[model samples]
Target: MTRPGGTTIKNSRRLKVRVKTGKGRTVSQKTWLERQLNDPYVAEARKLGYRSRAAFKLSEIDDKFRFLKPGGRVVDLGAAPGGWSQVAVQRVKATEGKGKVIAIDMHGMDPIPGVVIFHKDFYDEDAPQLLIEALGGEKADVVMSDMAAHATGHRQTDHLKIMALAEAGFAFATDVLKPGGTFLAKVLRGGTEGEMLKMMKRHFESVRHVKPDASRSDSAELFVLAMGFRPID
Candidate 1:
């Protein structure tokens, strides 16, 4: 069946794999492993050589929204493991040298071709300027952040942390995005609020929430996409 965001849901039955708890395996770890093994997107990502199942999240959103165009410059915040960077590079044709992808993360990631990577914390004052310099003085067409804080198992605290990251990404995007550019960031449900939502509405022609099929059904994670940036002097 075709779902929203153009994802086709396959209704095939497979034998469920049960993880046997070993001496070193905790129940939570076993549960996570079982879920990973059962996830069709995870299998598909492996088959296609994509870095993570999260790649499909970006793909589905872009498929629906038609952002991430060829010959465009993009900045990816918290780009560790490089799945989204891989998707961005292909969609923007960066490998053909027609576009550029700049990705930064606090943790190190293996290099991806066609993407310039910075292994540094985005909170550093110089990080945004470094990304701009990598663009060769040209403003970016898209700035996307999939960054999420480590879950503390406290829902409210986690939501606030991710919101902080999203807001920081927005600030950086405003400085580096070209007129009519796009900004996409991950946020928990009820995360976008108060001054940030107001600012996004004022600065962008349109803003909306998107939850792709690749995101688990129980997940509170949602993406906020703002398009048609209105630059102010």
Candidate 2:
């Protein structure tokens, strides 16, 4: 099992939650449901009223990196279900009017307080202009994307699809992030050090691969964290 940052998490001893194969239930679906039912983070998320378990992933990342500071402007790409956006709002103090949190997604989600939401795909021709206009000429302090392509169950093919999204997210981040800003996006372990990593190293002062404890130990998902953006002259 893979742990983010190469750290280990011993599964706590508890009663295992199991789902029986029910009528018309696919094995994959049963497996997913069982995992969700037994996940501690899922239980915690429900208790805390978070939109999804992914909320803890962002919190854990920021707890170490301290990138999501109060008074910072943040942009969250692929912000469906608004889990990450929820974390951003609290971290940036957007509700207190000290910071700004903007979320964009093609799919609709219920409103989250203190976030400026755009219910349009990030790839829309006018999307960039719309977000820029909302910023009112101020550059963002951070651009974070938790976007992942739907898994194809083929490791290489899945890796390629997600890397494409990560690269695209970085491209957009370059257009809106300020000097010393951060770009954080999800990429699979396979081929993470390829062209996308090289591109980020050229523009950011530091680049690292981080896997939060919130990430399942068996998952190939991880994030590339690039900080201290240096605009191309």
Candidate 3:
């Protein structure tokens, strides 16, 4: 038996909904489904009309860091499903003409009121140029990414893939961010590589790793936040 603050389940009156194993459903899939069904964040996301539970992760981060400011120019890399982009639009007041937000991802998403969307992969040669053009040559105040490469079940392999994405996002951030800009990207828990950490330290006054409470405790995910960017001429 479960309740979302005594909330009802989707089209159901029962507080505790059970999923019995079916003929076609595998054990692992059944387990995953059950977890999703009961997850408070999932329920909350639905209630709030957020695309995914990931919206809370970014919202939680910004709540503490206060980086998504009004009138700021922002970019969101690999922003599909538009959860983070939605939050950015609200915080920056983009629809209200207070700021601009550009979002790009390989997969297309429905339009968000205040975000400029680019339906292309970040690794494409044209991606950077597109973001630059969208920004109208203005430097970005923040570049944030929650993108993750497809996970292989192997922990080490998955870690390496995510780190690769993080490193790429960092490189892109370096080119696009204004002086004193902020960069936020997801990384694995093992840690950011020393060389990359050193490079970030050189560019930003403070570089710290964050694990928001919204993240699942069993997951090794972390976010690297670099603030007060120092652009080298």
lDDT of 2 by residue, 1-233 (tens): 22222323235445898899999999999999999888877776776778988987888889889999999999999999999999999889999998999999988779999999999888887777788778766889999999988888889999999999999999999988999999999888886546788889999999999998899989988989999999997
How big is the positional error of residue 179 in model 3, measured in Å on the Cα after superposition?
A: 0.6
TM-score of each: 0.93, 0.93, 0.90
Candidate 3 per-residue C-alpha lDDT over 207-233 given as tens digits, one digit per residue, 9 for 90 to 100: 998887678888899989999999877
Q: Can you write out model 1's per-residue Cα lDDT over 1-233, one digit (the tens) per residue?
A: 44223445445356788899999999999999999888877777787778988888898899899889999999999998999999999999999998999999989799999999999988898887788899998889999999988989898889899999999999989988999999999989864454577889988999988998889998999889999999987
Give the TM-score ranking, best first. 2, 1, 3
lDDT of each: 0.88, 0.87, 0.85
Error of 2 at 88 (Å): 0.5
Which of 1 and 3 is ahead in TM-score?
Answer: 1
Ranking by lDDT: 1, 2, 3
Angstrom error of the Cα, residue 114, model 3: value is: 1.0
Candidate 2 error regions (>4 Å): 1-13
